[model samples]
Target: MKTPLTSFAGLDLLTSAVIVLDAEGSILFANASAENLLDSSFKSLTHLKLTDLFLNGEELIEVFHQAVAHQFADKRQDLTLERAGREALHVHSIVTALDNPDTPVLIELRENVQQLKLDREERMLDQSKANKELIRNLAHEIKNPLGGIRGAAQLLELELPERHLRELREYTQVIIKEADRLQTLVDRLLAPHRLPHIVGDVNIHEVCERVRSLIVAEFPQGLTIKRDYDLSIPEFRGDKEQLIQTVLNIAHNAAQALHERIRQGDAVLTFKSRVVRQITLAKVRYRLALDLHIIDNGPGIPPEIRNRIFYPLVSGKEGGSGLGLTLAQTFVEQHLGVIECESRPEYTDFRILIPLP
Candidate 1:
């Protein structure tokens, strides 16, 4: 006999999609989350088998069979779920055997972002806190001594009247120039923090377009910027110019890294935007958020500095000040967002996640 539908009433409260099935893989019950995830009403879903909802579900079927045979829990990752007339979903799922014979297997489905979102959010938050404290303390220490050193050099230069010590004036000029350079560096470090966010409705695609145009204009010859935007994304409150600067910083770095590929006329930079659901950023869970990906075909980030790319003054490129990514991070954080990167040789993906109201 089949399990009664009302037996799994308590499962409706679960956020993760869940289904209860008999030993033969026919679904006995699906929770509210399962309904939402599968985009089908429970009444309609009741007529379908569990494995029928997926494409290439042979492994998933085996997982279910094993769970039923051994009465143990089985875990699987990166399972593709096929939806009729809709894009497929990549999911991670777990199957567990039930004590009841009528409903022998319990399957829980977790969308791929559950763990990835938490891991990246935690990493970016910790890194941002450390970077902020370091920048603040370092800037304060440098600024105090910096002003005095520049002032003293100016006085010493003037006092060494163009007479016998004229050549010595060159030394004073060097000191003043170096001090000024250091001061400028300190200012740049503090620039992101100093500016107040001018919050307004910000269309992320607009920002992307601006950055794309600027990059194309700068490169002009060898790079192609492709757009894959989800027009349904609504505008949210943010500083438009800051967001623009943030994207430009990341895109500019990518373009610079793609110099060899660009020279060969095969460079590609893709700006893909989509709406992600239930993402966590900086310890806060958001129901909806924007995920903007800047994907590039380049030599990839140097492995040595890849971990510290967001740290101030840590640049992998020749003559790079290394402040670009740092500033970019600060700007994104100001908008309550986080940027995460994954890279390999000839491919790089940078994902920016910001909550939506």
Candidate 2:
């Protein structure tokens, strides 16, 4: 008899990963969250046994059998899942046996740290808003004083007595130069607030190509910028220049991080794009969205400060202004999007998602 597949339709709406199997452990169905966690489609998942996903599933197999042995029993255990060319995932798995004859066993998998991740994301979003507001206020307070100081320095240099001109010129110049430098920094801090949104048609590929050209020009040798784009992504309304600046800032930072790898002549930075459906951003749900990833093969971001990388003036690199990522984050948020990053020893990936029509 056919498995009760229609009864499992509601499972897709759940954010938890779930799979159904017949009495003999043949797969019957997989849910949406399961498809995403495995990075496979429903059809492909249906063709594979639930045990095949585990790195060490002999125990999981026993759990399946034991659950079936006592039809109404359920068990929970932690399992490490592995897929080819992807990082291993740690998930908490639950196996339950139903009283029904056709579909007896059900496996529910949940990311072991999903709740913690969600909590951290919410906290970080709140912290970021507070940090941005503080920076904007601080920048405004500093801007006017900076101009006054620079003007006074210029006037003093002009009025210095002739006999002391040469000696005092050096001192006056230092004050003037430092004032200008601080002025520039304040302007950058205030840039996002000052600039008006100039929205128009935006082709994501075109933005990628522009960033590619700029990065290629900046790092002429020992660096490769690879492009993997989905041409099917249609144009959407956005601030093209802001988007370009956002991507450029991120690519530029990746290039700077690849200094040693670039010297070794094997640095690879990839720009990959795809259309992701049924995604949510900043508490708003969208049926379709654009997914863009900037991946780099370099020494990864230092974990010590990774959590605060987007905060103003927090930089992993020496002498870095640390505003690049902060500015990029602002730009993406202006488009009602989100930016995220994952880093390990040899790989770093930055993803930006924006809602699409």
Candidate 3:
């Protein structure tokens, strides 16, 4: 009585959007989101070609052809389509290979490209300004108290008697130690702004390989770091050290989060690289982009706080400072790149998109 599509109807209802298209780019099914966005029913869309949804239908058909060709070779392309009565939506259509080549279907992720562009740029500008303010306040407000506490500790240590000295010394030691700790925190907080960028023509794989070796050396037990790179990518110009630090920080966090699994003896951290064309991030359009992904099998980020993870001082870990990702983002932004995170219970992926030459 129930069909495969019928069985997935519940899932389709739950998703933000889901639509199925045949090999010829004609809609086979459309979910609620698609219906609402398109302002039409499945019956109408099913009878029309996919290109009909876009204003520039003919040009879009060619783009779809190019997308299918790339997918045939196991690659992906960025696609933009503008609807007649609604705003334009950007889509990344992926074609799945099947024994029946003509019946191959394409899964498309449609989103508001213009809004995402504006949001990304606004967030970057706001974050850069906030970081500058944080550094200035940290250097002034936090540093003065820290120095006084450390200085007072030495002065107090001189006035105590031998028997009572240990107790007073311990008290002073606490203040001194806490002050020193804050000093270290302050230094790291201001690091990205203070450090000079070493710009040059550097290969991205070299950066990934360097971080992999460093991580493996520290946690060589059960955690595995794997790489999947596209060799045809050309060398990109950027600050090599900053890139290393940015990647190392994210990779280290993934390794630490995999402690339980690593102790149980099966944890994997994968580094994947590919080339993307006509990609946009932070309001700037790039002809090409270098896509780097850091994937792990450990328990993913908690859903409740995933959206706020990139904010400064927002940490999900018990003893974590939470500045690692903030610093990583700052460094990446300097090189005209953006990093995005997506996670579920079993999988967590950190995607870094950098502009290419």
**Candidate 1 lDDT over residue span 221-274, tens digit each:** 989999999999999999999999999999999999999999999999999999
Candidate 2: misplaced stretches above 4 Å? 1-109, 112-120
* Clashes within 3 Å, all models in order: 0, 0, 0
How much is 203 displaced in model 2, in angstroms? 0.4
Candidate 2 lDDT over residue span 265-332, tens digit each:
99999999999888657767799999999999988999898888899999989999999998998899
Better candidate number, 1 or 2, judged by TM-score: 2
Q: Where does candidate 1 clash, by residue pair? A: none
* Model 2, residue 123: C-alpha shift (Å): 2.7
Best by TM-score: 2
Q: After superposition, how far is residue 107 of candidate 1 from its true place, in Å?
A: 16
Q: Relative to the true structure, how large is the alpha-carbon lDDT of every model?
A: 0.88, 0.88, 0.78
Clashes by residue pair, model 3: none
Backbone clash pairs for candidate 2 read: none
